[model samples]
Target: MNTLGVTLVLGLLLGVWAQTNIERPQCDSPEAEEAALVAQDYLNAEHTQGYKFALNRIEDIKIYTKPDGDKTYKLEVELLETDCHVLDPTPLVNCTVRPKMMTAVEGDCDVVLKRVGGVLTVTAFKCKTEESTEDICLGCSTLLPLNDTTALDFVHKSLASFNNFNENVTYAVFEVGRMSSQVVSGGLVYLAEYVVVEANCTEDPCVPLNDAMAARGICTAKGSSIAHSVNCQMFLTMMPVIDANVVDVNSTVAVTNSTSAVAPALPPMVHVHTGSLSPKLGLRYHKLTTLHNPELSGLLSAESTESDEVVPVAPGVANSTAPADAGSDSSNSAEVPVVVKKRDVPIVPVVPAPAVVDPIAVVPVCPGRKRFF
Candidate 1:
């Protein structure tokens, strides 16, 4: 082929390669996604009882992407309650300004960003009454006291802890897989995207709230970090679905209502023994070996013989019963003698037993059996 033909073929191949490599951006900017998340958060904030008047107003949308690096955008949101509300302005709610971070999900092409509220609460309505019921409750304290940076830090720490889990355990695998896949990598990424979008959704401040159900804080204990709080609220709560076999009325009530009642007083104590009881102590147990066990009862009639009883000797006393010195009287028999002889008894030598060694007996060699190595 001619040189010009070769060059044309090479040029065509290069163009195809370039076209395949090109990666079109999914959204106009990462900031747009963050705006959406802030908006959703604001809507959720309105549903909480005291913070019913809280609303989010997007102040600015800024997109930043490092050249050939992950794209990030910041959504500056203003969170405030209207004149009708009386909730204290916390760092999370009733505050005038808040910011949420958003990043593009690495692979997904859709411009839509997914978000998860760091703060979450669930409540159940009981006949739409003003009275409180556990059925309609607020929860998800895992999200409390955390902002963008702290939330991300917590997520990273969780991922690290999962990575350290042992692979041999079945439960560890399940835990690690669930956290790393669902919550850590996938859920967190999507959540960050949602935060960005929600933060930019609207410019209206203090979105009106008709009536709210409850308010709550979400606090999660991540690895090595102290529990953090995320302020949130909810309009409805979901009840846990329990199986019939798993629900035990009596036992479960005891566990759930530990603080329900005060305990009764204990009975008074009585002293029985007057003299030294010695606690009837030691490992020597008195056995009732016969039908009428007299040994167990220490009590006896006044005429009972005490002659055969042995008395314990005091420390450092000579106990020999040999006849006392010639001048000693009968009363001196009860006293220990200090003039006892101190004799050194001769030591008996221990003879060494003979060591039995095995006899070296020679066996008769078989004819023609030996061979040279």
Candidate 2:
């Protein structure tokens, strides 16, 4: 090995670890005023138990970024609780009451609101008087469950593209980041960070040396459902604004379990001429077809007849093959020559619903009523 070459390769591998964690330095307050405006919007428009709360004062504000480089803010604030009631004597009109204000002075209870990009929303909140830590502090509360969601299914089940993809694919490594939601079309679209570390190819039963060298895959998902996913690269370019689930953002990649597999692992970000490659996820970006090439055949055939290594497949769907050009969105009119076959996998479970945010607009108490005074 070239001494200079070896030294340079070592530098490349360590560069990725340089990415920032949300804990390093915390902001004393919100960075942009827009965050507060967004916060206020959350409260004035927030309706609970037939009561709408008005923003009183902001208790505290902190800002941080997610692993995917998107910024979000945490705001602790007070709200004035108000409820509407039918006046006993008046049939056509209703009167609003501030019960929390009637007899006793209402001490502010802390409610945290998150503002990311232009979509402002709320998550489950509890006030904490204790000085906050990176993982437990109220500042990090919005980012709770710092662990990856376990055994979740990939949003997209089928792979269609110019890249001849292998059915029953397995990943050497898989990971997802914190969950975040955005407003799109008429509903909230939730997303998470996604990455695939090592993978197999369509042409060769095992990943090839060069393709695995370039075996980049970061796919994510969209839709109100957990059962759908799209490739990140393809999703970014083709999917509409509402988000067909970010393609690579939350990709559904299956992991490889067989040890007799011949596929070479994709090299780590930092190159080491070591005997084996240490696979890392969420680094490179390989196209759907890059993992695929139409030229190779008999890729799925395993050399060892004694052992069984399972490939990942969408639940309840038949295993099948398609052309690289047939990628994700061929017109329904196009003729797909392959027969879809069923391979029984575990059924997909229902994903928890996306958290609710304050309404974008407030509805009126009466047909024409806008204010109390």
User: What lDDT would each prediction earn against the true structure?
Assistant: 0.22, 0.29
Q: Compared with the true structure, what per-residue lDDT tens digits does model 1 show for residues 62-145?
A: 222323332322222223322212233333343332111111001000011112242222110000001112232232112211
lDDT of 2 by residue, 1-373 (tens): 6999877754543232223122211112333334444544443333211123334454444333434654434334443433221111212123242332121112132222344566655532322111112222221212112132321222222122102122234432233422334555555554443433344443333332334343334444443343334443321232221123223324433322223323233222221111221143321111011111112111121221112432433421211121111211222101122211111122443522233221211221211111221
Candidate 2 regions with alpha-carbon error over 4 angstroms: 1-47, 83-101, 104-117, 127-373
lDDT of 1 at 293: 17
* Top model number, lDDT: 2
Error of 2 at 328 (Å): 48
Residue 260, model 1: Cα distance from true site in angstroms? 30
Tell me how far the alpha carbon of residue 201 in candidate 2 is from the true structure, in angstroms, after superposition.
71
